[model samples]
Target: MAIKHILKLLLQQKGISLLIILQVAITVMIVSNTAFISYATLQNWLIPSKLEENQILNVTTRVFDNNIDIASLIEQDVQAIEAVPGVIAASYASHELVLDSQGPGWTMFKDTQPETDYRVFGYFGLDEKGIDVLGLKVIAGRRFYPSEYIKGSFQSNNAGVIMISEELSEALFGNGSALGQTVYISRQRIPHRVVGVYQGKMLGESATYSQQQYHSGIVPEVLWGNRQKLNYLVRVAEGVPERVLQQVETALYHTPGRMVQRVEYAARAKKRLWDGRSTFAFTMSGISLIACIVTAMGIIALVSFSVSLRKKDHGVLRALGASRSMVMTTLIKENTILVFIGLVLGFPLAILLYYFLMNNVHVQSVVELPLLVAVALFTWLISTLAVYLPAREAAKVSPAQVTKSS
Candidate 1:
């Protein structure tokens, strides 16, 4: 048959064509939503940190590392680690070095800007030695003056000075020198001057781009070393043996009254964030599957109904000597064309839902092309499965049984 004949037949059988198209459209919608949500979860699991892996081990002390008098003890412990052979950089950080709530950062406004809903900058109390250990780079302005380290006067020095990452600068002030401008920091109406801006050392990169999308486009982890903070981390030298790690662990074990029983990092980045995300993704997948199944069932029923209505026409074609294979192939070609038409219409809408709309709500990561291809293939598969049974039944029609006697 020519193109006109096929199109004319499709136009005549509008009800069946429309039913298949609608089912495909629903399948595409559900698949795109599921993909967008899945990727969003993956992005949050791996947050970025600048800590040098391979060389780093985070050590905790049950002792009063946070005690005021224990500040001297904490500094002494770090100095002792400095004496250890092959120990390159050892630093003490308050809560800043760890992730999630252990090192939370915020951006408080000078005068709260309702339009700009921002959090405050994270605080770090780094001694000169600890500063270099963290390896933070200055993009603009200078490091903290020594006078700022004095226990009492230190608060005065810190009251006005603030240091932050380049990402944060762009998030708050568009573009320009972030220096010299005083930014507000929460309920206190207190202002901290933007003394410097810096970039974080690339950390946790291995977690981001694995076979899974974990750490891509995550927020930079802020590193602040406070002497009073017990949550200290150390980066050992290369070629160092397990004996060295044992010695460090031994040092903690033999430290006077308190004991250091455990030291470990979470295998994955942020557990709670990704855990909730995974649950959400699984739920969406279930919903998507159900929607696709419902659509497939509807398409099959509608197509079967249409095939029954047009049974007499197929009988006429069979009387004209069209072989069973030829008749079956024609039906397959017709339905496949309807599917293609549905795809052309459904795909663009799926893309819009997955990208522009879904990412904004999820705040995870933006969905990309690979996800798009997955959704399209899934939608096509469901639609294809729906027409299979109808196609097989159409192929089994008999001409002589329907013909009238002359």
Candidate 2:
């Protein structure tokens, strides 16, 4: 009987009730999507680079003059960098260090012929010391032998040996061992032998959202060319990356034909690459918090307005043998029904919004049922609390007050 009365009261205030329902629906949609985005951002930011980030340094240099002996200059720079007090190992890096904004060169790799099954991978070129300089662990097989090292241009196919990450090994060879297997690079007719498989991460903007984040390969080649930028990876001893970074430019600046572009710790470069994601996570979190608070405030305002207008009705019920608790319970039940209806409408909107994000915005996380249920329960709780104070105030109205007002 009490619920029927509350339903009739709600029908009488259709305008205010509909407004509150719309507010709840919009809030649910925005909050749910923002929460998922924030979660995905944080997950991407936490992916490990699998390199000795703090103990390594990234140095970039460019040779503008075509007459300069690029190969000899690279060799000289590596030797000078290794002579630094804190330096452990240094190598000529054909590509920029991992986790940088610059994308690595990608190519197809296949284990067997008719080329039906193949996986795309990001490729990097480093010498025999590349594995140790980047702190990669050779889980299976062995590192490149000294004889395998060669000096070549970026586009040259002089490299005959390759090392792959564990992730790539699993992708290419499945459960079988990839050691000593001949794999073809790109469309080249030449087959390069896989010498080793290491565990490491070589992340870039293109691979950030894909399973290929760790699908990378390293070649035993010291790449240098006329009028091309040269990169080097330097590994320093513990507690001296900063000190080594300071001396790297001076060590590499032996002549004026080349320009030392920049020298920085690998850890700092990785952080710089991920700073955008971090900011995005924080921004979305703040928006979610504000949306929840605003929804709560909206519920409170609408429910309070309804109670004020129904005060005389509450007073009359109290006069006709209804207790204070009964009056409060009736008002609470009315708002509870409104909240339920709003949630029923809000759920569909939330799902539609999630799909829109997945398609257009490339949202990485899935729409979990538990998270949706939690949001619904949270909305219900907030609405119930918002109505509590207003219900209590209405329950205090006296029969004499209604009679006098009438």
Computed on alpha carbons, the lDDT of every model, listed in order, comes to 0.61, 0.76
Q: Cα lDDT of model 2 overall?
A: 0.76
Cα lDDT tens digits, model 2, 1-406, are 3677677888899988898788777777877776666666666667777767788888988887788777787788889999989899998877677653223335555744664476656677777787778888889998888887777655555568888889889988899999999887765535788888988576444455543678778787766653468888888888873656778889978677788888988777777766775676677668877877887788788878988898888888889989989988887787778778888888888788878877786655456677788888877787778778878888899999999999
What TM-score does model 2 achieve against the real structure? Answer: 0.79
lDDT of model 1 at position 394? 76
Task: Provide the global lDDT of candidate 1 against the true structure.
Answer: 0.61
Give me the runs in candidate 2 sitting further than 4 Å from their true place: 1-12, 44-48, 61-69, 101-122, 142-161, 171-173, 180-193, 202-208, 211-213, 221-228, 253-262, 321-333, 340-374
lDDT of 1 at 131: 52
Best by lDDT: 2
lDDT of 1 by residue, 1-406 (tens): 5666877889998877887887777677667777777776665555445555446665666554333455566667787766677678776654323342322333356355566455434445455555566556777887776654434212333335666667566656779777887777555555677777777533222222222211111111223333333655666776677566667767656556556643443222235235765887888789988988898898788878878887887777788887877777777677778877877777777767766653465324455778877777777677677778887787677787567621
